[model samples]
Target: MEKITHISVELRDWIVNTMKTGASPEAIANAMIKKGFDPIFAYRTLLKLVNNTPVEVLAREQQPYIYEIPEIGQKGNIIATSDRDIKVLMRVEKPFILYLENLLSEEECDELIALSKNRLKPSRVVDTATGEIKTVPGRTSSGTYYRLSETPLVATIEKRIEELTNFPIENGEGLQVLHYKVGEEYKPHFDYYPASKINENTGGQRIATVLIYLNDVPQGGETIFPKAGVSITPKKGAAAFFHYGNSKGQVDRMSLHSSIPVLKGEKWVATKWLRQSEILERS
Candidate 1:
């Protein structure tokens, strides 16, 4: 018979209990191996269990991302929201970037920054291995998030975004406002979560991002897409909309981007991450 490759609930509980009782992870893996578990499977399962993250066993194989024209990426030069007319500044098809101007007004931008400044906290990134949010060296920024339509300003912005993108507010993961000071930068990274960590209830996969610039930077603070050789300057009221995922369960690697260090003035931006399905919590 093949070695045990599946972990039962009882076995998973046993591993957790043993780990809390001072048993090393290696010892647990070795025990599982001795009990006829595949060596690799034993080690992998033990690691996830120790980290307190789900040990997701995926049967799906990796497939190339199929490119499809998203509604927001269509050949439109203008998006008419209920309160504003946003002009398409530029477009890049390879990675699906639709740069826009006037996504927010001058007053709106200032208010968002004012509201977020007081609530700023050290930013955190999701640990790929454990699927937990933690502060790391790669990302150096301060940020805050607001619930969907929590305030009048946020409600107005979210509604405008819904009108522009044709995606419901329920699919948005709330609006996150980030601030970067001189020398603080977020290294190159993708916005989407790891495949195994995508929670269906929270909205399956992160499909796109609407990054709105809130303040003008004297220098640097450009959003760089290294693979695509693209750089977007920070202009107040302008935004970048990049679609990276599709219904075919594919994520575009070319959408990888980063916020380079600010050389002069501070940088402020609000990011709205969209999901493939409605986020249950927000819905």
Candidate 2:
């Protein structure tokens, strides 16, 4: 939102020419800095131009056909293929189903909704490109979230983990729900360690993630991993499970994902993150 300084018609033409020659924004910014321009000014100017340009113009300026995750599964019930079986869906391989169809009853859904009415709050929204911070605006799209550590839902979700993975479940800092209304979507990103500034190694390296869809959207609202070629739609009461850490504590890189924009209706999901250690170091 802050305006960039040092951006002029000449600088704009230089940037456009450089881009025509296949220079990335980073490369262009560095080149300008070396030529006595402020690096931040160059970077910010580029961002402003990109943001202000029409989508069609920007598309012409960048790569054509950016890869996207395709919609694969639907709401209700379906089995998921493991990484070994599918090879494309990366991380831990196993067949699993969306839990929304059978995990919780309508009454239970109502209960969870009632509980969320007061507890759900805005989630931290980060602009990965600019390092800007803002609270997500509303319950629509990638906005509001309820931290699971403070909710009864955590216990229920852990029991399901035990039944499915046969691994003892331990409580941690808890999960967060990302609710999306029509037209809302989360961009591609990785779910790993939050920066030190946020939690100071508190999450102890996320090991796995379980996302349970609480409400069904008539269409769209899929969890997508473009690199993995996987997309799963939102279903009432169903969950998606994926592992991110190895037995030796190395983080798996394949867990990067995104949420496809909701085209119609609404979506609500409950997320559970498994940690390598207890949330609290001291009892």
Candidate 3:
């Protein structure tokens, strides 16, 4: 990283005054650029100064709440909050990854794999241009998924959620086990629609999504969010948590995401969609 110039006392005073008047760092940097200082230099300088400054010194500061995974069936993990504005990443440690892999014994994995041969189903998708339903060709290789109802795995995951977020997950509306063989993939799409458009039977808008990768693919399956610049490879037993809504109750646009196409080996995963209200209430 390039070192930024030290912020002069004069510039510090300016930053304090500008911040007091509700100007963002970007705004201040733009102003400085118009005054002849290089925009990049001003932005970098401001970032270094602000990051070096104590939180108590800033007029506004966002204190992040840490969510640690407790010992569940024999292992613990930690997932730190990413950014305040964007609730993007919640990564797991390696040991926790191993623990999750162990959750399902090798025999269980083999049984699931065998069962998958008979359970493989094609994914149904819609065409945006022509308003027609279509199947993704060759994209449906060999994969199987089993829905979750009230399984022990579901209960364990729920317990972990309560420990991490202090939020209670009631009964899950639906659950699924997804298996991808060598070349299966699901394209990009958002999970929840606006409240005005959702059907009565589908219930309220989805609040969060928990995706747990069951078996790791030796090559090529990744969840990529093109717009957000995030790509996560499938890791056996690791989970990804993504929240869709903001404090203002609006869903983020950049959250539009997709699943990467599998390339060389099979992949297996479990998914759960959470809603804002009970299914009965929505009905």
Best by lDDT: 1
TM-score of 3: 0.53
- Enumerate residue pairs that collide in model 1: none
| lDDT tens digits, residue span 1-283, model 1 | 6998887543454455445433467876886787688999999898788778897543343344578888987738987888888999899987989989999999999999999989999998765434446776767899999998889999999999999999899999989999999999887777887665688999998999999999999999999998899999999999999999987777887787889999999999999999999998653
- In candidate 2, stretches whose alpha carbon ends up further than 4 angstroms from where it belongs are 1-101, 126-133, 136-154, 166-171, 194-203, 281-283
- The alpha-carbon lDDT assigned to residue 18 of candidate 1 equals 41
Q: After superposition, how far is residue 138 of candidate 2 from its true place, in Å?
A: 14
| TM per candidate | 0.79, 0.57, 0.53
Task: Please write out the lDDT profile of model 3 over residues 87-109, one tens digit for every residue.
Answer: 22344331111112233334444
Clashes of each: 0, 10, 3
Give Cα-based local distance difference scores for all models: 0.84, 0.52, 0.50
Candidate 3's error at 209, in angstroms?
A: 1.0
Give one digit per residue, the lDDT tens place, for model 2 in 100-130.
Answer: 2355555655667666656555556443232
